[model samples]
Target: MSFVGKKYKLDKSENFDEYMKELGVGLVTRKMGNSLSPTVEVTLEGDTYTLTTTSTFKTSAISFKLGVEFDEETLDGRNVKSIITLDGNKLTQEQKGDKPTTIVREFTDNELITTLTIGNVKCVRVYKAV
Candidate 1:
């Protein structure tokens, strides 16, 4: 219930590399990195949650539960199947598909910090609740 109706942002500096790596990329992707700033809005209600990610590049939306599997895509257009579970105060999103990635989000310093990994590159993005 506490997690319901809460919002967060990505801490780009600390999470970018991790995110991309999880998406299945190597140094090549990092070398050709694009300047992207993604923001996420989360609304957890009852047994389901709605999450939205938006940036200059693309926007994605996801709705799922603790054990439910759902489909999602990255800003660069990578498809994935995702399932989110709670680990203490953090939420871990385990993604499956052609690109496997894991994203972790937690509340820190009054902001939401997210980390992503594709292959070798990692990235972090941060957002403040609005």
Candidate 2:
């Protein structure tokens, strides 16, 4: 996969803290989340794809097969049933749990652009390849 082993650094974000509040994330957690500029990497081995996110606060990773549902513990501590699908250069994830959320990651040659939506709130985060 072209994206495998490629790294992306968070360059900017919009309305992320508001989106976190919609998810019922606590104040402290939301503040930390807002301050974090994480690095993300995706890797593949055989049939499994692993996406890892790293920040000064913590590191989180999830592994799954495309189109298959898996249990996920989100960065903000939500336990979710998640599935990821791909179309062209966009990877879309749907998470069902206490609240349903949709995350879409669109990869371009120089950036990974992510949009998060939940409860009418949408947050966009741009990560430049480095």
The local distance difference test score of each candidate is 0.68, 0.93
Question: What does the lDDT come to for candidate 2?
Answer: 0.93
Model 2's number of clashes is: 0
Which stretches in model 2 have alpha-carbon errors above 4 Å?
A: none
How well is each residue in 1-130 modelled by candidate 2, as lDDT tens digits?
5778899999999999999999999999998888999999989999898999999999999999999999999988889999999898888999999899999999988899999999899999999998
**Local accuracy of candidate 1 as per-residue lDDT tens digits, 1-130:** 3544666554446655555555555776654544555677778767887878776656777888887888777555678788898877688888787766777877654678777666665666677765
TM-score for each prediction? 0.70, 0.97
Highest-scoring model, lDDT: 2
Candidate 1 regions exceeding 4 Å error are 1-3, 9-12, 15-34
RMSD score of candidate 1 (Å): 3.7
